[model samples]
Target: MKAMEWYFPKSREELAELLKEEGALIHAGGTAIKEERIKSAKRVIDISSLPLNYVKKDGNIWHIGATATLNRVIDSLESDHFLVKALKCTATTPLRNRITMGGSVYLSPLWSNLMGPLLALEAEIEVLGRRQGTCKYEELLSDRGKFQGCAVTEVRFPDVKLIGWFDRFARTSTDYSALTVTIALSVEGESIRDAKVVVTGSKKVYDRLSGVEKALQGSRLEDVDVEGISRNVNVEFTDKPAGSGAYLAEVSKVLLCRGLNALGSAR
Candidate 1:
């Protein structure tokens, strides 16, 4: 390990200017700057000391600060059963403590436990100093890697009328998931009016699970075609010797079914 310089940015504007200087990684919770070694960063800007670590909810919008730890969000969401289910189904307690939701967005982790639910909920991110504007969650996490040198200010999730269900099939609860499925279902009178299904950890960078969403939309629970559900699914996966596409597809199916059965049927 080498001696690295540290800058403590006390404000969002200060953090933005520091980011413009280059070579420093935005330190949220100080977990990834050392552990993940994101791009061999030498200088670290401690964003934790700033005012970015807050979780606020006002009317229809939930505002989560950039440095807010996952545990904080989990604790807050416990009252909202839907959000609580999503957090509980994410990673284990230890990682959740160190893992800031902002870090997870910028990192755009492959087997991310956060992206699945966040994407389904249509979360929007606010980045400063580089991608210095509010952008859609998918846009921020796009392959262009807009978040490479960016610092997230916060993430905004608008309150919606959908009941969300998140399920991840890990080797174990403590282990990082091999894959995760989040289903935000809009059901009315035993029928799915609309659906947003997001699948993380596929052969591709990330999969939106548009196929499953299409099948369920406007279809009654009993009318959903089981055999044809995955036919048009645009799923892509890297063929790791350990986990093949077939295995992920199977897991996706099982988890999708579970989400649908729980949330899809809920009135």
Candidate 2:
């Protein structure tokens, strides 16, 4: 077996220089750095000491640094925040303490509880290195190859007040979710002004249900057909130990309707 080389860069400039090295991978919380995943990598750059572990609200945007752990981010938000709801259901308390926000977003695994909510929130990811600016989360997922040498610096999202709902399906509470659904809506009076819907653990890893969102937009919350819209959600799932692809698709529809109804009743 080839020995692994590790580099600890305490500053952004130092981290940038290390990123230029061939076959180098960033190690923040180290939760996602499995041996099989890094078998071809000969170098690991540890950026835990960098000044990137922060959570702050600036004006109408919430900024979370790359190295901030899941628990830290959850603590920074309101008890009812969508992110807190989703993140609390992620892994376990011990694991959440070790899973960093950047690592989860950077390598959005099939079971990730973060991606669906982030997509629903239309969050922007800030990176340093090859890509040194903020880009929509969907854009990053679509063209991840272009960010090979990049280091995710921060994730920021609008602080708008939206009714949020999150749900995950797993045999056990601590197990990876077979399917996850997230919904956010802006309601005025009895009408829905805007809506965002997202699902994870699908064949595409994650998907934004634009069709569903469009159907909910400008509709009276009480009149919206949640069940009908959920049944029409176009998504493909891959078979997993928890359930078959067909089974998951059906399950997703049920969860979507339940989540939407829950949000609708919240208003």
Off by over 4 Å in 2: 1-4, 36-41
lDDT of 2 by residue, 1-267 (tens): 889898988888888888777778888888887788688788989898899999999999999999999999999999998889999988888988999999888887756688888988889998888667889988888888988888888999999989898999998887889989988999887888899988888898788889999999999887889878976787899888888999999889999989878776766
Alpha-carbon local distance difference test for all models = 0.74, 0.87
For candidate 1, write residues 73-95 as lDDT tens digits. Answer: 88876455455665666567887
| Model 1 ranges with Cα > 4 A deviation | 1-3, 35-40, 78-83, 188-190, 230-234
Taking all chains together, the TM-score of candidate 2 against the true structure is: 0.93
- Error of model 2, residue 104, in angstroms: 0.8
Top candidate, metric TM-score: 2
Q: State the local distance difference test value for candidate 1.
A: 0.74
Angstrom error at residue 31, model 2: 1.5
TM for every model, in the order presented, reads: 0.87, 0.93
